[model samples]
Target chain A: MFKKTILLKDTSFSPEDKTRDVFTRCLDYLREKQLEQDIQVVRVADSGVYGQGLVMKVLPDATLYVNLKDEDVTRVIDAAAQNKTIEGLALKKAPKQIRIVLRNCGKIDPESLEEYIATGGYVGLKKALLELTPDKVIEEMKKAGLRGRGGAGYPTWMKWKFARQVVADQKFVICNADEGDPGAYMDRSVLEGDPHSVIEGLIIAAYAVGASKGYFYIRAEYPLAVERIQKAIDQANAAGLLGKNILGSAFSLDLEIRLGAGAFVCGEETALIASIEGRRGTPRPRPPYPSVKGLWDKPTVINNVETLSNVSFILLKGSEQFASIGTEKSKGTKVFAVTGKVKNSGLVEVPMGITLREIVYDIGGGTISGKAVKAVQTGGPSGGVIPVDALDTQVDYENLQKLGSIMGSGGMIVMDEEDCMVDIAKFYLGFCVDESCGKCAPCRIGGYQMLEVLKRVANGQAKLEDMTVLRRISQAMQKASLCGLGQTAANPVLSTMKYFESEYKQHIENKKCPAGKCSALSNYAIIQEKCKRCSLCQKNCPVEAIPGSREDGFTIVQEKCIKCGRCLEVCKFKAVSKT
Target chain B: MDKLTPEAIDRIFKQNRQQSANWIKVGMSTCGIAAGADEVYATLVEEIKKRNIQVTVKKCGCLGMCHAEPLVEVCVDGMPTVIYGRVNKEIAVKILDKHVNSKALLNDYIFDLETK
Candidate 1:
């Protein structure tokens, strides 16, 4: 086996990669020195660092050297062989992503309770029961300043404190794992990765609020998450953490898993409570909020999977410790599923006040296709678009709302130049319209009308005056809708119109899709100058829009073209053009 | 499975922490499993037992890097703890041979992120 290994990747913007050449030269130099058998050199797909010319990581020593020149290859090999340090070339990487909510994730065996306890998982719950009273638990949460991570940004302490104040024979706490956001799955990961953490958190919430029972309202779609949580509950019960006086105290609580039938509106508190009571999952207007009157008309507390996971962490690692990590207003970290055209798309937990630019470029490694980011869409359907210019703005609860977006469950979708704002807005609005419960007329009717206007806008049939109509319907839905679902459903439409209004105007005035995303307004044609008599586009077209021979050359029948852009993608010579 | 008292939590914590010193953790969450972590996990277990390697293979959750799934984090006696991403069955065998048996670290696959 090789003694030392050097992993190299040329992360430059140039299309022609020089990693192979550099790898070969390093091998040649090692062979010349007769050190080839001692040291191994390999080319990697991702060097984990981008835009830093040539990134080479020397293993065993774990010395990272970036921006290497062709001449520096011999010096790097020599330094590694001699076990000498290179000061100028070493890159010290500081981790941008932090994990508090995901502390035990990937660290411990999630299914093993013994392993979880070893990681100090249930110590928080033990402290909450033995040391602190219900009021004191809420006070500790208040010091932590953790807001509800399930979109609304309500203070977690305040919610529990309200439920604590209500005099009732019985109270309930629910872990809302019904993660229905289009591209968000932070909850499922946490549940599947560290089910015991969530269970411990839910038990602590029950203890803090003086609840005798709790439920895990996870969506049926996450079968693995459900299975793990069920096993965790069983383990907790067997360990006397649940179904009795927990940890040899008077605090007795039982936990159950309630699976949602994949209704998006069930994520709302009142709707969730109604679903738990075996009713049609629909939201009821607040003021007799769930904290005041919830499941079975008794007081209830519903903490999201992410929110509760943080509770146990906050208690274990003191509230002051959790309080010190993030900004003044939005304390602690937020787990964001960074998806869409992003390069390194995954679940990233970053402390509040970190800018979108840092999250996208530094942590996410920018877009996958390496195109200019047009906008970063946050908060999913209920959130809004943030223009590329405002990416520097610090991410907090209030900051994002000012941009017409709530930090809705932390789904950050990066959009490139090719993604039309109008089409994107329509897609989100279409999802909300489909998932709308239709109990209230404003959401049912207003959402339908606004989607119709957006469809008209995409089809190039909308007028400048139609903007007023869209706003009117949006206002109606936001005001007259019964719950959070309808109230914020029009956010995508409103925010896209606010930020990318010029792109929308291009659709109306120029009768063109700026990104060529709206198929109704875009057309595809083959350019003869670029065409190399390739008939691949003709055979690949699903609609048979391109009908021509290789020798005679082909023309796209515009009327028959579905504008799927298959020809644009399949064309090897770059013949197809979309306009 | 006696109901654990408050003291037993601490007892369990101490006992499990000292259970093993060297092991390989496979990310077995939905994302990792979907990326064929099951195969990577099975291969590691089979290779460790077949090769009589004095290390254990365990399952854990996703490490937030779903884009690079089938992530395997290894902790050996001499080498620093490192995560290897996008690992397949072939790479699994190579990790055992090179990183475990021969006492050399894998070059391209080590994703070392020092957390705060």
Candidate 2:
């Protein structure tokens, strides 16, 4: 058996991989020293470090060495064989990701309550029930500085305190699992990976607020999550964790699951409460917020899946430990479902103060297409786009809001150069328009009007005055919208226009999409010099836009051209040009 | 099982704290299952049983690496615990034979994700 393992990868972007060459050289050196059996050499798909030259990580003790040459291979192998470190070559990369909410995600069996307990799960609830009072629990939350992860970063302690102070005979707690963001699946992963944690959080929230009943408002779209949560609730009930006299404490709470019909607006707390009440899912004005009046006209505390997960951790490990991580205002880690144009599209739980650059490059492995990243779209439709220049800004509740983006449900979508800014704004605005409940005019009519103007801009038919009209309408919607959905619907348009104003100007003035994404603004033509007269473009054009024989040479008829890009895709000699 | 008191919870926690050192965990969440983790899990179970390998195969949830799913984590004595990504039936067999039985780490498949 090998005493030590060395994993190698050619991290260079060159077409020819040098992993094999490095591996062979290392193997030969090990053999020469008669240490082949002692040291194991292996090639890896991803060495966790990118853009460096050939990279190798020595295992049993993961000491990474990067930018390696063939000569360095022997030194790396020799160092590993002796379990010694090479001074200049040994690279120590501190991990960018820290899992708090996702602590037991891959560690224990989520379905098994015993495994969860073994991993220090539900211990938080036990402590909350046995040692801490309702006010003490709120104090711990306040000390932890935990905030709601559902777009609006409200203080969790204040929400519980408000509900606790209200003189009501019947109070309720709801776990907002109705995650409706387009690219965000952080909640679903947590619910599926560790359902007990969320349940424990909910029970603790119920205990803290003196509520006897709680509900899990989950979207029906997430069947797996729903199933897992249901199983977990049953297990908790069986173990006397969910039913009356939970952990033999007087704070007994009954929990139930409510399925959403997959409406995006229902993710809002008021709308979620409305949906649970068997009413139309639409947001109402806040003042007598959900903490004061919610679900059947009773004081209710609504916490997000992530927020509750943090609560369990904070209660288990003291408030100081949870508060120690992240920025001052936003404590603990935030889980982001990093999707769209990213190399590794998955759930990443990172501390609040980590930079977007570190999350995108170090954690996400950069963009998938190997193109330059233009911007990152955070906070879903309610949030805004953060330009690449501002990517170095530390990610937190206040910092993201300062960048004109809310940390909305942690749906961070990375946009590369090929993604059109105007088109992206239009897409997000269109999603809001479609999901608008038509209750308030600001969201219903204003969202539709903004979408119409954005469509005109994308089609290259809008005048310069239309940009002003779009802004005016966006401001009106932001000011007058009755609910969070309408109020923040214009965020995408406002933010994209704020950072990518030049791209919009290009679309309006030059009638060109800089990203070449808007088909209506794009025109295709056959480069006469480059064309081989092979009739390939002519044969592939579905609209019959290209008409001419091989001898005559094909030409694209502009009027008939659908701009489908089929000719561009089928062209062999780089004859078809799109501008 | 009855309603667990605080003392009972502590006892259970202590009792289940000591886990088997030699075991294989397959990511069985939606992301992993969608990426064919179920097949990889079945293959590992069958192969280990067929080979009579002294290892336990179990199912867990996603480790946040969805891009390289069907993730299988193997931990055996003398071998460092490693998570292998994009695992299939063939890799499962190789893991049982080479990694489990012979104690050699597989190259190119280990996803070095920092989950601390």
Top candidate (DockQ): 2
Off by over 4 Å in 1: A1-7, A24-44, A58-63, A71-89, B112-116
Kindly list the per-residue Cα lDDT of model 2 for residues A1-579, writing each as its tens digit.
Answer: 679988889988787998887787887788899997888888777777888888988888889999987788888888888889899888878878888999999888889998998888888898889888989999999999999999899999999999999989999999999999899999998999999999999999999899999999999999999999999999999999988899888878999999999999999888899999999998888878989998898999999999999998998889999999999778889999999999988989998899999999988989999999999999999999999999999999999999899998999999999999999999999999999999999889999998999999999999999989999998999899988888898889989999999999999999999999999999999999998999978888888999999888989999999999999998888988999
Which run of 10 residues does model 1 chain A get worst, by summed lDDT? A40-49
DockQ class, candidate 2: medium
User: TM-scores of the models, in the given order?
Assistant: 0.95, 0.98
Candidate 1 residue B52 C-alpha distance from true site, Å: 3.0
- Pairs of residues at least 3 apart in sequence or in different chains that clash in candidate 1: none
Q: Please provide, for model 1 over A1-579, each residue's C-alpha lDDT reduced to its tens digit, 9 standing for 90 to 100.
A: 556778778988779889888988997899899997778777766767788898787877879898998888788888888887699788887667678998888888888998899988798888889999989989999999999999999999999999999999999999999999999999999999999999999999999888998999999999999999999999999989998889889989989999999999999999999999999998888889999899899889999999999999988999999999889899999999999999888888998999999899888888899999999999989999999999999999999999999899989999999999999999999999999999999999999999999999999999999998999999989999999889999999999999888988999999999888899999889999999986999899999888889889999998898888899998998888888
* Candidates in order: C-alpha RMSD to true structure: 2.3, 1.4
Q: What are the interface RMSDs of all the models?
A: 3.0, 1.4
| lDDT for each candidate structure | 0.89, 0.90
**Highest-lDDT candidate:** 2
